[model samples]
Target: MPERSLILRPLPPFRLDLTVWALRRRPENRIDRWDGRTYCRTLVIAGHPVWIAVTEERAPGAPRLRVTMRAPVLPAQAEERVRQTLERLLGLRVDLRPFYRQLGGDPRLGPLIVRFKGLKPPRFPDLFETLVNAIACQQITLTQGIHLLNRLAQAFGRRVKDHPEAPPAFPKPEDLAGRDPEALRALGFSRQKAQAILNLAEEVVSGAVDLEAWEDLEDAEAIARLRALRGIGRWSAEYALLRGMGRLHIFPGDDVGARNHLQRWLGRRRPLDYAGVQRALAPWRPYAGLVYFHLLLKKLEEQGFLQKTTC
Candidate 1:
């Protein structure tokens, strides 16, 4: 199939960073690897996968952005959906105009302008691979969970290309429909994890679960539907809703990292329970997802996840 390319100009800085951060989480999403030049990631849209690459190069006039998107799907409608997905992921429509005006004159927040200058919300997958990996990881350490996901991908996912360094695309529902549960078990998936994965796959294959449509639903409805699945509960549902549908208000309160960060941010002596989390985040409203991302970034910064980037 011939590839189609689209260029996006003046991309938001925060959104670009967010996209890079997300792609770094898993190898399958690595769309390009050019040191100090460009970064890229792949995403599946309308069942057709595509690569998006962005680079900022010094130009004679002004700093220029070069964005190249290569996809098999070519219609304007499909392109529009991809564009909307990027916008939604980056929270571009929320209009921080008021916040900018309010803080423009404030001394304390003035410095934050430089730090947070062009930060934008990130784009992520409709179905969160992390959430699924987390459910399979329950009570296990981060290392164990990552290993399990790697194994799962190797066992069931397809090898679309043999890029020696990059992992393969995770198996789709049909890829695992006929596999024996024992196969996953042997791959170190707990019995419960195997069951949940199989159940999810069956739901996907049977058309009982529609991730795309679910992405457009309200948070409450989306969470309710996710929880209806046998293996998915509050944590999994919230995680999935946040990643899958961009529902910002729903927090996986069970995440120890989130709880700890909230504790410190609120100056609370004790850990926060679910209700406490809800109350604390009430002020953030519809943009709670952005808040969560910020908090996570803050925690990562504190923990030395990456060299502290200003703001």
Candidate 2:
């Protein structure tokens, strides 16, 4: 296996650590790994499992990332695919300047923005991964969800060619479509969730559902179509929109943790429901989802999972 390297120039003020934290969410997440300096993940690209390691170059106003990839045999488009996937995963192209200008001077949010300057809203590698994540996390704590996903990946995901001990890539639809629902149940998924995951995988593998096609649809339309799926609901649909399709306008109102985050951040005496969340986020409009990520980082920092970086 030959190793290859490339450089990615992200929009300035980019911090790979913060964006990776937002992507990994819980410290327990095994799929996306960050060991203080570098971020690493294995992806099954063009039928080969490639291990990617990315590190920040730390330029003052122009940040660059160094990406090193190792695989048994690199496909012709491997670098391009890996580059595109990393761009989406770390939100390298998302210019938050408009978002900054929108509410930079606000008393409460200003500090949060300043505190996490280079943080970007990250997305799952693809729509299927996003939906699978949403399904696994339904009604469960994020840590538990990540644990289940880790188990699922270990059970079905493809391992790197030379590193059998490394954590496997997240399972693809083809990897799980023909799998037994009972096997997922053995991994601590409920029977309903197990069936839903299998069904979704089958649909994706069979070409019965074109999850990528949702890219062209508006947020509401996409949500409605996603809700039509077996296990997807309002929250899952909106989550996919924000995290999968890169629609930053969506803040999953049904996300309990986010609602609690908002309630606490807003200093609200009463707990906020879906409607209350919508109302509270109305002013932020398109950037509300960005707010959600900021609050999530705030929660992570408070929990000691994220360290304060000097600005």
Candidate 3:
């Protein structure tokens, strides 16, 4: 199918760059590509491969996304997936008004919310990708972890020939499940990490683990379920809760990078341990994850690593 552009009317205060950055994490991310003005990715929609490039413009007092989708599927079918993907990745329906009204007055987090105004917390395409990402990032620098993910994508992910830069979708469970751990180890994963990935994949494939069922679970319950899995610890579980399921209040308390940001934001002299982080974030209730996203943007801005938008 030829490329087609459709419009998506999002709730007020939506910034594509902020949402894309939150989803993609780093400028080097290959799965979600942002070229400043637009965000591009190749998604598997209804089992059909599609390429979508998304941009936004203001319309009649509301923000709207201009989505261009190209694939072998019909435009109408592709539009539905495009809309769904944007809603998931950009958090279009997530109402931050209450959070803003509550935390917007805080001395520490208030300025952060202002700095990254219109920011929305982003989630992985699926629970499987979220778990895979957490496994890859365990005890490693994020850059290295993402490199491993890129290699893994090139190895097993599928793509269309429509666009040269269409990032291959993250590999499916069928692609990784039952594969030899050494195959993943060859992509620079630790042996244990490789085995863990394979195990999780197999479990998902075998119906032993239903990650999507966590949607009906509370944050604590979801965290406990994720932690019960081998190779997933407190940080990994909490991280998955936030990034995988969009549990916006569940900040990965053990995240070193987030801890650093929290410490600096609070002007603390020493680093915050997991308990300290919990204490500091207690008043925020379920919005500490929002603070994490803002701090991530602050770091990227300070380092001049945030992607540039042409529009």
Candidate 4:
């Protein structure tokens, strides 16, 4: 396959960290790895695997990004899509709006703006895997959930050529629908989780559920359809909607992290209920999804959820 290289001009300051986070969440997605001077993750695009690399290069006495993407499937238009995706992940559009005027500005939040611009939401496939894994991982630690997801992917996902490092493709609905529910249990799935997967698989295989169609629908419409599934409730539906469909406004109301962040950011001693969160976030309309991620990132920083780095 012919290799392609495209320059992402005037790259946003936080692009590197944002891309790294998306790549790291699922190691199987990586087809190759390089570190130092330039960092790159080789991944599959449009059924063909490709390598995406980024580095800071000095040009005209200023730092600029040098990005290289090699994939037969990297369409000419993909650069724009990738940029939009990165922006969505970093909460760039959501954090800057004047919507949160009610919450008095804190000088502390200033430093966060730069860093916040780099926080990319996890990838869509990873998000789906998380939802499935979370269902399998109720009351379990983060480590356990990851292990289960790894096992599921290993057992059911298809392998891609020339990408030994790439994760197995998630099982198609038809592939899983025919398998015995206990088969998944043997792979460490709980009975409930196994059943849910099968239910989802059946819908997919029977054409009763269309993942593609769901992706194109409005957020509210998508959530309603997801809720109709047996194991999917409001939380699961919102989780899937945001990650699966890229709906920027839906936040998982049941998440403890989300609740805690809202309380802290708003300077409220008590947690905000669903209505309160909605009301507080109303000004950020059309960009609520980005706001939701910013809150999570802020909480993570405050609680030392990850290592501190200059944004």
Using TM-score as the yardstick, the better of models 1 and 2 is 2
Q: Which ten residues in a row are the worst by lDDT in model 4?
A: 25-34
Worst 10 residues of 3 by lDDT: 302-311
Query: Residue 25 deviation, candidate 3, in Å?
Result: 1.5
lDDT of 1 by residue, 132-174 (tens): 6656767776557767876776676544232334334555677
Pick the TM-score winner. 2
Against the hidden true structure, what lDDT does model 3 obtain?
A: 0.84
lDDT over C-alpha atoms for residue 236 of model 4: 78
Q: lDDT ranking from best to worst?
A: 2, 3, 1, 4
TM per candidate comes to: 0.75, 0.97, 0.94, 0.68
Give the clash count for model 4: 3
| Structure candidate 3, residue pairs in collision | 36-308, 36-309, 37-309
Residue 210 C-alpha lDDT in model 2: 96
- In candidate 2, what are the lDDT values of residues 159-218, reduced to their tens digit? 888775456899999999988889999999999899999999999999999988877897
Q: Write the per-residue lDDT of candidate 4 for residues 152-250, one digit (tens) a residue.
A: 767876554564544454555555787898888998878888898888878777887767667777778877887787777777778777765566667
C-alpha lDDT of all candidate models, in order = 0.59, 0.90, 0.84, 0.57
Candidate 2: regions farther than 4 A off: 308-311
C-alpha RMSD of each candidate structure in angstroms? 4.8, 2.2, 1.9, 5.5
